[model samples]
Target: MHIHFIAIGGAVMHNLAISLAEQGHQVSGSDDQIVEPSKARLKKANLLPEQVGWFPEKITEDIDAVILGMHADINNPELVEAQRLGIRIYSFPEFIHEFCVNKTRVVIAGTYGKTTIMSMVMHVLKTLDRAFDYVIGAQLEGFDSLVKLTATSKIILIEGDEYYASPVDHRSKFHLFDPNISLISGVEWNDSRTNISKEDYVNLFETFIETIVPKGTLIYNKESTILREIVEQTFDCKINRHGYKMPEYSINKGVTYLHDGDYRIPLQVFGKFNLSNIAGAYTLCEWLGVKRDDFYKAIASFKSSIRYLEFVASVNGSVVYQDFLFSPYKLRTSIHAVKEQFPCQGLVTIMELNPYDVINENFLPQYASSMDESDHAVVLVNKESIKDKNIVLDDLEQDIKRVFKHKDFVFLTDLDALEGYLESFKSLGFNLLFMVSPKHNTMNIVSFADKFFKNF
Candidate 1:
């Protein structure tokens, strides 16, 4: 099979290209901007585009299929040419569905913890020496690529994202994946370009449940009332609802210990949210025929994905960590997780409202009081971003202040001011947390911390 990718520089797009190339499929791709990691990885695999821009000549009918990435615009020249030539174009999610149609597809979906849960299950499977294909959102420790597909693998674990599949496809990406085994971490709407109303946001997950294959199982977070209601009222699949009301666990001196009736296993990762994710992963593994003992053994060594609670530096008892958290629910969960781990320390939380949904004026209220759990909270937003998005800065700050209900909490639009404020802070044995999505500009914080705490 011959496959060509339009806008293949995307993180997932590049991985899919390499996965197919490794599978012995003749693969070629073109992108307007091929950036780091993707560029280097594709070069190493001999799949990087010779040129940066798209070429209509590259869209020949000889290609078996053309995979379109969300990064590519609808009016992309190669895409237009592909359509003119009557060539089939598959959205990234659609192409994934094509490959896993015959396999037992296990999709993990939610605004948060999907990647972690998928990684956990994949790690367990790999430890068991199970031959399976997978496509997780983040890079795992041992995995060379974010995607792996094979003709012989009978199962595929995918991190199902709810964002749009393509500019032409208005449906959520997860809707394209008809999973035999599905898990919904929780419902927290995002990607404001697609989801306009809260009801519409909730409906997307319902649609995912309705799209499940016959006799398939849905493992959902019963803790989310919205998800529970949607699954109960809308879904007819064999539902196995799981919640956060599991056995108690605690963190002791940076180590997490889980209690399972008579068994207690020490975990390398800490936090209650992570514990819930572990429970969700455990349920999925059990459904996949992994015994309890084996699951525990694999999870004991799990060190979470990169940039999700990743350690940045430590200076005089002040530790700084960065996480890929942007949505209100995720922000609250991450803050609580840090507070739980370092309850005695003064927690300084910095959040970047860079996502389109979070920066929008209409969605500002959803973030109200999301950071109340932190001892000291600061909201960071680029003023130019507000102007670019056509959102009012005063309106955003008012809503944020109202939600936070703290007079000491600061909101800064200038990077220099934020940097100065952070540098001015005296060492107070506090834990500093910086949270934002990958698309946000956070390298400044990383750079500042690296320079200030070089010796530490």
Candidate 2:
């Protein structure tokens, strides 16, 4: 079979192209810009487009199917040609579903902690010597690609998001998975582009819960009032609901230990959110027939996906960590996790309002009490981004200061100012925590961390 991708350079799309190629399919793809790992990975597999731009001539009817990335516009030239030739088009989620339709799909969904929970489950599965296909959003430690597909694997793990499946397919990506087993971490309105109101966002998850297969198992976070309320309502299908909260755990000398009846298993990962993540993963893995003891044994070594609470450097009783936390829920959870993990040290958090959605003046209020856990918090945003998004920083600062409950909460829009502020903390001996996100400019973070840590 021949499959062409309209925007194959996307992180997930490129990995899918590689997966399909590995499956012995003739896969070809194009993108306006093919950058870094995607370019190298595709080139290694000889699937990278010979040229960067799209070619209508390549969209011949001989192509069995064309997979569209969310980055591709509906009117992309190759897409237009594919439509003219009456070729079938599948969005990324659609194509993924096509391959995993026969497998027992286990999807993890939520506004926050989905990646961590999915990574936890994947780590345990791999450690337990299980064979499975998966498509997680982050690059886990042992996985080469963000996605993996095999014809033989009977089960597949997927990170389900409420964002659009594709430009043409306006439905949330999670709706397409039709999971036999599903996990909802929690629902918080993250992307304004997808759902403008809180009701619409909550309804999206409600719709997702209904799409589960008959007698499906839904593992959810019991702590989420919104998710709990939604799941209690009627659904057409007879589904099993299992809700999870933080397991019994204690932080000893900056190391998190999970308690069994008598044995305490030390974990590499820390934070209450991660503990909740572990509980959700344990529940899902248990349903998959993994022994509780074996599951905990494997999960003890789980380090989580890259860019999530990654230890960057340690200097003079101060440590710096990096995390891909952007939304209010993520920001608050990450901050609390660090403070709880190292109760003795002062936590100085540098959070970049890196995602465009959170940069909005209207969305600023959601972050009101989110940063209250931090001894010192800096809400970092690019000045040009504020101009591009038409956000009034002066007004946003008021909301941020008010919500953070700290009169001294700093909002830095300049790189130099941010660097200067971070440098001043060099002598303060506080734990430096960076909360960032993708699709946002994070170079400043790298540069600042490198410079500050190198100075010590």
Candidate 3:
């Protein structure tokens, strides 16, 4: 089979291209820009495009299929050529579903904890010698690729998201995946980029509920009132619903332990959201034929993904940690988790907001009291992000101050000012918690951590 990717430099697209190429298919791709890891990985797989720009000649009649990435525009030349040639086009999800239609599909979806939960499931399965293919958003430890598809695997675990599948396909990505086993971590609308109202966002999950295969299983976070109501009100759907919450756990000396009767299991990952994710993963694995004891044993050694509460450096009692937390709910929970783990130290949190949140007026109220747990909170608002978005910096800062209940709040837009602020904390001996996301142009967090904590 011959396959071509329109925008192959995407995080998932490049991985999928390599996987398919390795599977004995002739895979080719084109992208305007390709970055470090993707470029290196694709080169290793012998799948990197010879040229960066798209060429209509590459989209030939011999191509069996063209997989379109979300990064590509609707008017992409390659996509236009594919359409003109009457070639079958697929979104990555659609192509994934094509190969996984006969397999047992498990799709994990929700507002939060999707990546952690899916990673836990993948970790336990791999430990137990289970043969399965998967598509996850994060790069977990020991996993070589973020996307995997094989003919022999009987089960496929996918990290499903409620975002547009592609520029051409307006359907939500999760809607394309009809899962035999589904899990919804929880539903809290915070995606201002989608420009959808709260009710409309919730409706996406309600529609996703309808997509579950009949008589299949659904594992959900019952703690979410909105999600629970949506599951209950969907009268036409036929599925077995299993609701899970945070399991019994305790933090001792900064280590988390899960309790089961008289046996106590120590975990490398901490936080209530993670504990809940473990519970959901355990439930799903149980249905997949893993015994409770075996699942617990394998999961005891499971570590958090690199971007989740990852330890960076430790100096005496003060430590620096990095996390990919930006949403209001996640921000509040992560702040509390770090503070709870180290009750004796003062936590100084540096949070960077996404550009979508900077322009949206409705997102400010949701951030109220989100950073209350941190002793000192710094919010980085990139000045360039608000350039054409019609945002007033002074008004935005004042509104943030008014809404957020942090007593020691600092609104900083300059990276130099942020560095100086962080330097001032060195003498104060406060633990640093960096909550950042991708596309953060304000500061290079990992570099800063290494240079600042070099001696520590």
Candidate 4:
């Protein structure tokens, strides 16, 4: 098979290209911009385009399929050419569904912890030598790529995203998977452009549940009242429902241990949220016929996904962490996790208003008390980003101030100013918690912190 990826520089697109290439399919791809990791990985696979920009001439009928990325606009020349030539074009999710159609699809969906939970499932399965393929959002520690597809694998684990599949396909990416087994980590309204109203935002998941095959399972976090209500109202009887509560546990000397009756297993990862993720992973593995004893042993070796709560450095008595938190629910959960882990420390939480949903004036109020758990909060928003997105900064700031109700909290528009503020407080011995989505400014927080803390 021959596959050509349009806008292949995307995180998922590049991985899919490599997966196909590794599967002995002739693969070629073109993108306007190819950044690090993706660029280097494509180069290593000898799949990177000789030239960066798309070429209509490259989209010949000889190509078996053209995988379109969400990054590619509807007006993309190669996409247009592919359509003109009557070539089949599949969105990334659509292509993945085609590959896993025969396999038992295990789709993990949520507003938060999807990547971590997916990674956990993959890790446990891999350790057990289970023949499975998977598509995860982030790069895992031992995984060669973000995606893997093979003829022999009987199961395919997918980190289900709620974002629009493509410019032409407005349906949520998760909807395409049509899962035989699914898990909803939690739900919070996200993707501003796709889901406008609260009801509309939630209806997607309801529809997702409805799509499950008969005798399939839908495992969900029992803590989310809204999600549970949706399941009760919409899920069909054939779809077996399972609910999970946060496992009983305690952290001793910075190490987290899950206590299930008399059994005690120490975990490499910290936080109540991660503990819950592990519980959900264990339950899913058990449902897949993994023995409880084997599940615990395999999970004991598990490390967390990158950037979920990655440690930066510990200077003096204060430590700093970089967390991938964007949604209001994630913000609240992450803050609570950090504070609970270090109760004696003064928590200084800094988050970048980077997501389109969080930056939009209409959505700012949704995050009103998201950071209330933190002792000191700093909200950072890039002014240029707000202007480019046509969002009002005053509206965001006003709502944040009203919701946080913390006089010590400060809102800043400049990264340099935020860095300066951190530098000045170097001697304050405060534990720093930085949360942001993948944005131009948020991506640099680690570099800034490294430089600032090294000198301090």
TM-scores, all models, native as reference: 0.87, 0.89, 0.91, 0.87
User: In the order shown, what is each candidate's alpha-carbon RMSD?
Assistant: 3.3, 2.9, 2.5, 3.3
- lDDT against the true structure, per candidate, is 0.81, 0.84, 0.87, 0.83
Query: Which is the winner by TM-score between candidate 3 and candidate 4?
Result: 3
Best by TM-score: 3
Candidate 3 regions with alpha-carbon error over 4 angstroms: 191-193, 384-399, 426-429, 438-441, 450-456
Give me the displacement of residue 269 in model 2, in angstroms. 1.3
Error of 4 at 375 (Å): 3.4
lDDT tens per residue, model 1, 163-210: 889978878889998899999887765555443688888878888988
Model 1: CA > 4 A from native: 190-194, 238-246, 315-317, 355-372, 383-403, 411-413, 450-456
List the pairs of residues colliding in candidate 4: none
> Runs in model 2 with CA error above 4 Å?
190-194, 354-359, 365-372, 387-411, 426-429, 450-456
Candidate 2 residue-wise lDDT, 1-456, digit = tens:
999999999999999999989889999888999999888999999988888998999998799999999888988999999999999999888888888899999999998789888888888999999999999887777888899999899999999998889888899999998999999998765555344788888888888999898899999999988898888774555898888888898888888999878879999888777788899999999999999899989988888666778888776777788887656777887888888888888887887775465555577677777877888888777776667666677876676677678645888877888878766665345788888775676446667776665544
Alpha-carbon shift of residue 441 in model 2 (angstroms): 4.0
Give lDDT: candidate 1, residue 110.
Answer: 84
List candidate 4 stretches off by more than 4 Å: 75-77, 190-194, 355-373, 382-403, 410-413, 426-429, 447-456
Please report the candidate that would top lDDT against the real structure.
3
Model 4 lDDT-worst window of ten: 438-447
